[model samples]
Target: MPWILVFLFCLFCAPAQAVTIPGVTTGASASQEKAPPPEPDVEQKKAAYRALADVLENDTSRQELIEQLRKVADTPPKEQVPVITPPEVEDQKTVLENITDVGRHYGEALSSRFAQLYRNLIGSPHKAFNPQTFSNAASHFLILAASVFTLYWLLRLCAWPLYLKMGRWGRKKNREKSSWLHLPLMISAAFVIDLLLLALTLFVGQVLIETLHAGSKTIAFQQGLFLNAFALIEFFKALLRLIFCPRVPDLRPFTIQDESAKYWAVRLSILSGLIGYGLMVAVPIISNQVNVQIGALANVLIMICITVWALYLIFHNKRAITESLLHLADRSLTFFSLFIRAFALVWHWLASAYFIVLCFFSLFDPGNSLKFMMGATFRSLAIIGIAAFVSGLLSRWLSKTITLSPHVQRNYPELQKRVNGWISVSLKVARILTVCVAIMLLLNAWGLFDFWNWLHNGAGEKTVDVLIRIALILFFSAIGWTLLASLIENRLVSDVHGRPLPSARARTLLTLCRNALAVIISTITIMILLSEIGVNIAPLLAGAGALGLAISFGSQTLVKDIITGVFIQFENGMNTGDLVTIGPLTGTVERMSIRSVGVRQDTGAYHIIPWSSITTFANFVRGIGSVVANYDVDRHEDAEKAKQALRAAVEELMEMEDIRGLVIGEPSFAGIVGLTNTAFTLRVSFTTQPLKQWTVRFALDSMVKKHFDLADVRAPVQTYQLLPAPASGTPPTPEEPTL
Candidate 1:
C-alpha cells in the first residue's frame, strides 16, 4: 500500500521543469548570455510527454513507476491568449510590433513633439495663457482660499472655546467621567480641518491648471502631481492628529512621549512625500517620454528604492509600534490578545511583502502592472471602507436598540450588566458579518469569485439550507428562553404582593426550572444544527445518556436528597419563611433546593441542611401556637386577689393593639396549677398566630408585673437572715438587737 501511495504521488505531482518550461530569471544583466540547454533522453522525453497528456486528460494511474530523466532544454511557456493578434481570428501584427511602430525613431518622435509644443507656445502665447481664464480661475481660487481661512479661524476661535467649555461641563457634572459626546466633537473638528485642507489644495491645483490653459498631457501631469502631494499632506495631518488625540493629554488613548511622536512623524512624513512623488508624479511623466525598456527599468528601480525606504521607516519605528500595541494588548492578556499581537507583526510583514511583489512585477512585467495594482488596491480599500462604515452603523443601531429596550432594562433590572455584555457581542457579530459580505463583494469585483454562481450551484444550495436551519433553531431557542424567563420573573413579582411576600423557595424553583429549560433547548438546538450540517448526533446522545446513568449511580446521596426533598415538598412538611426545626438546627426556612434547605436563624446566620441529613422536621410557624406562662405566687397571698390581678393584667394586655390582634382568645388565669415549697404556681395561657407567640408572651409578662405591683401582691422570693442565737431566747434579743 505504501509503495502504491508513493507511486501515485510521483505520477500526479510532477515538477514544472519535468513537464513544462522553466521560468526565466527576472532582472538578469543584459550582457549575460543564456545558458545552452542539454539534450533530453528519448525514453525520458517520451515519459514526460505521456505524463503531461495524462494530466491534461485528467487520467490517473495507480501503479505508475517514476522515470529517471536527462537534463532538459528550457523554453518560455506558450501564452494561453495571443499577446498580439486574436487567436484563430484575423491576420494582424502582434502587440509588440504595434508598440514598436508607435515608438519608431523614438528620439526623432520626441524632438518633433517638443518642436510642435514649442511652436504652439510661441505663436499663441496670449491664447495659451488666456488672461481672462486666468483671472476667473484666480477669483475662484481666492474665494476658496478665503473660505478655507474663515473655516479655520472659526474652528480656532469659536470651536476651541466651545470644546473647552464642554470639557469643563463634563468635569463638573461627573468628575473623571469620559463623555462620549466630547470624543465625537473632537474627531469632527479634526475631520473638518482635514477636509478643508484637501479641498483647498485640490481647488488650488484646479485654479493653476485652468490659468495655464495647458494641453491634455500637461493637465494630466499636473493633476497626478497634485494628487500625490495632496495625499502626502493629508497623511501628515492624520499623523499629527493621532499624536495629539483629543487635543488633551488626559483623554489620549496612548501614552507615548511627545518627542518620540514628533521624531517618528517627521521621518515618516518625509518618506511618504518622497515615495508618493516618485510613484505618482515622476513615474508617469517619465514613462510618457521614455521607451518601454527604460520606463520599466526606471519603475523597478524607483519601486525598489521606495520599498527599501518604507522598510527602513518601519523598522526604525519598531519601538513606537511595540509601545502602542503593548498598551492595546494590555487591555486583555488572554490567548486571543497574544494572537492579536502576533497578527499585528504578521500584518506588517505582509504589507512589506505586498510592496516587494509590486517591485517584482514592475521589474519583469511592467506593462499594465500599475493599472492592475491600482485597480486591486482601490477595490480592497473600498471593501475595507464600506465594511467599517456599515459595521459602525450597525453597532450604533444595536447599541441604541439595547439602550431603548423596555423589556431589557425594566423586566430584568439586575441583568443590566448582562445586557451590555450581549450588546457588545452582538456588535462584534455584526462587524464580522459586514466583513464577510465585504470580502465576497471584493472578490466578485476582482473577478476572483462569482457570488451569484455560487448561490445557484448545488453545493451552495445545500450550504444555504444548513444555514437557514441553524438560524431558525437559534431564533426559536432564543424566543423560547426569553419567554420562559420573562414568565417566571413576572410570576415571581406578582407572587410578592400576596399575604406572605413571595418566598425564596418559589423563586428558586422557578429560576431552576427556567435554567433547566434553557439548557434543554440549547442542547436540542445544537443537536439539530449539527444534524442539519451533516454531523450525526445519535452517538453523542447515547454517550450522554450513559454518562448521566453512571453519574447517578456514583452520587447516590444526591439522588437520595432529591427524592427526600420531593417527598418533603409534596407532603407540605415545611415552607419558605416557616419557623422549622430540622434535626438540631432551628431557624426560619429561607430557601429550598432539590438537595438542600437554607435556614436563616434569628442571629442572621444561615444553615444549609442537606435533605439526606435531616432525620427530624419540626415547624413551629406553620399555624397558631399556644403562648403559655406559669407564674409562681407567694402562698401567703390571697389566691382570689392574685387571680383578680392576673385577670386585670390580661385584660390590659388585650387592650393593646399589637396583642389584641395576636391573641386568639382572652387570657385565662387557671388557679393553683402547681405548689412549690416557696409559692403556688398559676398558669396563664393564650393562643396566637404562628411566630407571634413570643411577642404576646413578652407583653403578658410586662403587664403581669405591673398589675401585681399595683395590687400589692408579693412575688415569691427567698430571703436569708443572721440572728444572735435565735435571740438566745426571744426576750432579750430586742435590746441586743437586731444583731
Candidate 2:
C-alpha cells in the first residue's frame, strides 16, 4: 500500500511541479494570472529539478513507475486497431511479404522436384557420375567436333581455289583501272568463305546437340560456343585479308612488305581472334545474374580493349597505311578529290583522339557516357560535314554565277578567270554563318544550351549584348565608310580630265573629306562601342579631351598645317595637276589629305609636305604668264634695228600652231634701260598661255639669233677706257691689261 501511495504521490507531484516550474509555462493559466511572474533564477531552477528527482529516486516509487511503464508497453491496441502506417506503405509491405512467401515456396518446390527427377533418372544419387554417363557425353562431344572439322575443311578446299581464281580476275581488272575494286572483292571473298564455314560448323553442332538430347545448360553452352566461334572466324578472315591479298599483289590494300604482312597477320590474327572469342563468350555470363553496374563496366572494359588493340595495329603500321592512302589519291584526282585525300589523312589522327575521349568517359561514367559520346561525335561530324558542303556549294555557285568567260576572255584579259567580285564577299559571309551555326549546334549537343539563357540573365549578358551592338555598329559603320570612299573616288574620277589630271582644289577636297570622314567615323564607332561594353566613357572622353588639348598645345605646327591645308583647298591656291613651285621644291600635286599633300616629282621621288611648309608658292598653270629675255648689244649698233630684228624673230614663231595658240601677243623689245662701258641692255617680252612660257622663251631665243645674223647686228663688246691723269704715278705696262 505504501509503494502504491508513493507512486501516486510522485506522479501527482511531477505534474504539479511541472505546472508551477520556473522558466516553464503550463497550458492552463492561474486565475486572473494570480500574481505577476517573477524573474527566473538559477537556484530556483535547480531546486525544482532536484525536488522532482528526489521524489522519483525513491526505489519503491521508481520500481512502481517501471512496472506501470511495462504494463502500458505490453498492452495491445484496441481490437479494432487504427492504422498507424500510411495506406500506401501498408499495402506495399503486405504485397511484398506475400510475394516473398510465394516465391520461397515455389522455389523450394521446384528445387525438390528437380532433385527428385535427377535421383530417379540416375536410379540412385550415387550413380550421378557413373562411367556410362561420361561415355555418352564423350561420344557426343567427339561427334560434334568431327562434324565441324569435316565441314570446315570441305568448304575451305572448294572455296579457296574459287576465291583465288576470282581474286586474280578482280586484280587484273583493278590494275587496268587502277582502282580499289579488287581490294573489296578480296575482303568479301575471304569473309564469305569463313562465314560460310562458321555457319556450317554451327549447323552441325546444333544437330549433334539435339540428337544427344542435351540439357538446357548444355544447349546454352553450345550456343555460346557457336557464337564465339563465328566471331573468331570473322576476325581471322579480316586478318587474312590484310595479309595474303589472295595471291594477287596488285590487290593489296596496305603498303606493307609481303613478308611482314604475312608474319604480323599470322600472329595478330590469332591474338585478335582469341580476345574477340573471349569477349563474346563473357557477354552471356555477365548478362545473367550479375550486378548491372559491374556488367556495364565489364562491357566497357572489353570494348576499350578492342579499341586499344585496333589503335595499336593502325599506329604500328601507319607508315604503310599512309603510303597506301596517298597512292590511292594518285595524280589523276581533281582539286576537290585532293582535298578529300587530305581530309582522310588527318582523319586517322582525329579518330584516334576521338577514341581516347570515349575511353575517358567510359571510365568515370559507365552509364550514359556512351550516349553522350556518340551524340558529341555525331554532332561534330555533322557540323563539319555540313559546313564543308555548304562552303563548297557557295564557292561553286559564286564561280558559276560570276564567270569571267565573257569579260576576261575578250576585253579584260587581265581579269580573273572566274567571277570573283562577289566570291570573296560570299565566302566570308558563308564562313561567318557556318561558324555561328556550328557553335550553337555544339552547345546544344553538349547540353549547354541553358548556358545561353543563364548568360542572358547573368552579368555576362551585358558583355554579349554589347558585343552584338558593337558588331552592328561596325557593320553599319563599314557600309558608311565604303559609301564615303566610293563617293570620293567618283569625285576624283570626275574631276580628272581626259588627260588623267584632276584639279588641285577638287583633289584636295576629296582626299581631305575622305580622310576626315574615316577618322571621325572610327572615333565615333569606338566610343559608342566602348560605352556599350560597360566602359566608363565619361572618363575616357575626359582623358581624350585632355590628351587632345595637350596635343594641340604640343604640336601646334600640325594644327597649323591642317588649317592652312583647308584654306588652301578653298582658296584654290594649288591643284593636283598644277605644276607648282613650293618654296624651293617643284612637283605635281599627286594627292592631298587633311594636313599634308603627296607631291610626286619628275625625278620619280615622292615628297609629303605639310601645308604650313608652303607659305609661298607659285602655280604656273593658274593663268597666263610672261617670258622675258635680256640681250646685251654693242653701243655702236642701232637699238631700234636690234629691237626690230627681235620682233621679226618672234613673228616667225606664229608658223607653228601649238606655239601660235599659246601666244597672247607678238614678242616686242623694250628700249634699253641701262648703258655701260661693256654694252647696253634690251629686253624682249611675250605674253603666252599658262605652262607655255618656257616653250615660247626657247623658240624666241633661237629665232632672235638667226635674225641678228641676217640683219648683221653686232653683239655687245666689253671695252676699257684709259685714264691719262693717273699715268704719272705708274704707267700701265703692256701686261697690265686695261679695265
Candidate 3:
C-alpha cells in the first residue's frame, strides 16, 4: 500500500522547476513556451487532490457529509457555460496548433500510406495494371459509399417525422416501447451504415495502395474515389448524430437538451474538408498533385455546409417556457408578465425566421450581397425593437383591462395559478431575450458572422479556425461557471427551511457536481479555445501520457479522490433524507458534500464526516421502520384478558379526537415484550406511512394510557431487580415474568 502511494505520488507531482529552452522563440510568452513556472501551486493542487482523495479513502465519514450537502448544490443557473475547457494547459495556442497538425496528419498519413502502397504494387515496371481486378474493386467501393450516403440522408430526414408519428401512435396504444423502438431503430440503422462505410473505405484504401493504377478507365476510378470519400463522411456524421440523440428513459421529458443531430453537419463538414485537405497535404509530402484541384473544390463545399449549420444554431427560435420551479420559493406574478411572455415568444420566432432568411441571402452571395446583408440586419433589428416596445405597451394595457375584482380574487385559486404562471413565463422570456440580444451584439462586434471559416477556406482554413474559436469560448466559460456556482450555492444553503448548513448531504452533492462539471468544462473549453487560438493540445496529451514519471510525483491523492467522486455522483449512491449510523454514532443526514459528510445527531448536534472514512455505514432510512409501544396493565387480570383489554383499549383510542390521524390502526400485543414478576407489560405495534410511524406510535401510546385508566386497569409497580446470592448461589430466582 505504501509503495503504491509512493508510486501515485510520483505520478502526478509537478517538477521542482520549469526550465526554459534557452533559445526558443515560439512566439508566445516564455512561460507558455514551455509550461508555466512549476508552482508551489502544484502543492496546492496536490493538496486539493489529497483532500478529496483522503475523503474517499475513509469510508466511515462519507455518509455523514452526504446528508448535509445533499440538496444544497443541486440546481443550475439560468445559463450554461458555452463550452468546457481544461485548466492544466498553460499555452493553449501552441497546443491547439499541435492538435490541428495531428488531426491533419492522421487524415493525410492514412491516405498517403495507402497511396504509396498502391504505387509500389502497380507503378513498378514489373507489374501490369489488371483491368478486371481494378474494375471489380472500384465498383465495390463506389456502391458501398453510395449506400452509406443514402443511409445517412434517409435517417436524417426520417428522424423527426418518426419521433412525431411514433409519439402519436404510442399515445393511442399507450406503449412507451413504441417511442423507444422508433428512435433506437433509426439510430441503429444510421450506425450500421456508418460501420459499413468505414469498412468499405478501409478496403478501398488497401486496394488503391496495393495497386498503384485505377486501371485504364480514369473516369471509373474517379467516380469510385469520390463516392467512397463522400460516403465515409456522411456515415461519420450519422454516427455522431446517433450517439448524441437522447432516447434514454431517465432523461426529463419535453425539455430542451443539446441538439446532437444538428451538430453532425459540423463533424461531416470538418471530415469532408479533412479528406480534401488530405489530398492537398499528402500530395505535397509525396510530391503528387493529380487530384488536388477537385479535392480542394470539394473541401470548399464542405466548409460552406459547415457555416450554414452554425448559422442555423445561432438563429434557432426560443419560445417562452414557464419556470415551474420558481414557485418553490412561493412568489406570485402579475398578468402584465403573461402578456410580455406571449409577445416575446411570437417576436423571437419571427426574429429567428428573419435571421434564417439572412443566412440564406448570405449563402447565395448575390451581387452586392454583403452590403445588402448588413443593411438588412440593421433594419431587422430596428423592426424587432419597435415591435417589442409596442408589445410591451399593449401587454400593460391588457393587464389593466383584465384585473380580477376583489370578490373574485377572494373566491379563487385557479385564477392565481394561471395568472402567475403567465407572468413568470413572461419575465423569464424578457430576461432570455435580453441575453440573446446582448450575445448578438457582442458577437457582431467580433465579426461573429465570420466565425464560419471551414466553409470559407476548407480544411486548411478550418484547422486554424477551430483553435481560435476554442480559446475565445473558454475565456467566457470560466466567468460564467464561477457565477453560476455561486448563485446555486446561495439558493441551496439559504432556502433550506432555516436549517443550519455545511449540511453534509447537500454539500456532498454540490461538491460532487462542482468537481465533475468544472473538470469537464475545463477540459473541453481548453481544447477548443486553445485550438482556436493556435495551440495543439494533442501533443500535450500524448507527451503527458508517455511520461510516466511526472504524474507519479504530483498530487496522487487529488486525482484518485476526484475519480472516485465522479463515479459516486454518477451512481447517486446516497441522497438527502436518510438516517445513517457510522461506527457507534448515529444521526439523520443533514447535509452532504464531496469533501465531507455532515450528520445531524438525534441530540441536535452535527458531525462532519469525511468521505474517505466511511467504511461501514448502516442506513435505517430505507424501507418501512418499526414502531414500539409499552403499556402497563393490572397484575390480577388474566394474562390473555389483559392482552385483549389492551387491544380493545387501542381500538377505542384510535377513535379519540387528538390522535386519530397519527394512529395507523388498532395496535397488536407482542406478548410481554419485557418481563417482571409483579406486573404485566404489553407491547403493541402498528404500521404507518414512512416517516410518520414515530408520531403515530407516540399518539397511540398516549391513547393507550388514557384508555387504560378509564378501564380501571392497575398499572405495573416499578421494580429494580437485584440478587444478593441465590440460596446455593442459585436460590430460586423470582419467577417474575413480564406480559
TM per model?
Answer: 0.57, 0.55, 0.30
Query: Lowest-lDDT window of 10 residues in candidate 1?
Result: 62-71
Off by over 4 Å in 1: 1-296, 316-348, 394-424, 435-468, 495-509, 602-605, 675-679, 712-739
Best by lDDT: 2
Alpha carbon lDDT of residue 348, candidate 1?
65
How high is the CA lDDT of each candidate model?
0.63, 0.65, 0.52
lDDT of 2 by residue, 527-575 (tens): 8887877778999899999999999999999999989988888998887
The TM-score obtained by model 1 is 0.57
Writing each residue's lDDT as its tens digit, candidate 1 over 225-291 gives 5454455555455545545543433323346666665665676666656555555555554444433
- The backbone clash count of each candidate, in order, is 0, 3, 114
What 10-residue stretch in candidate 3 is worst by lDDT?
Answer: 17-26
Best to worst by TM-score, what's the order? 1, 2, 3
Q: Give the winner by TM-score.
A: 1
Q: Which stretches of candidate 2 lie over 4 Å from their true place?
A: 1-286, 289-304, 318-376, 391-426, 429-471, 494-502, 532-536, 584-591, 597-609, 665-681, 722-739
Residue-wise C-alpha lDDT for candidate 3, range 1-739, written one tens digit per residue: 9999985564344231121111211122324635643434555566656654554455544454344334223424443212211122233368879999899987896677556544543463333446665466556545644554565456545554554454455444435553455444444554565466556655565455334434535534444455444544544444444444444212112233455433443544564445332332322222222233333343335445544654454445232122322231133234335545555446545545544544343333322333454455555555556645655554454455246665444443234444554455555555545545544543453355433443357773775466456534743675566555554455345432465655444566665666677788777776766666567889977886766456755856645554554555465545566777778788877766555567888799989866665667776645455677777665665677667667776777667765566545555568876666667678877765446677777666776666666666777666666544557656577755543
At residue 230, give the lDDT of candidate 1. Answer: 54
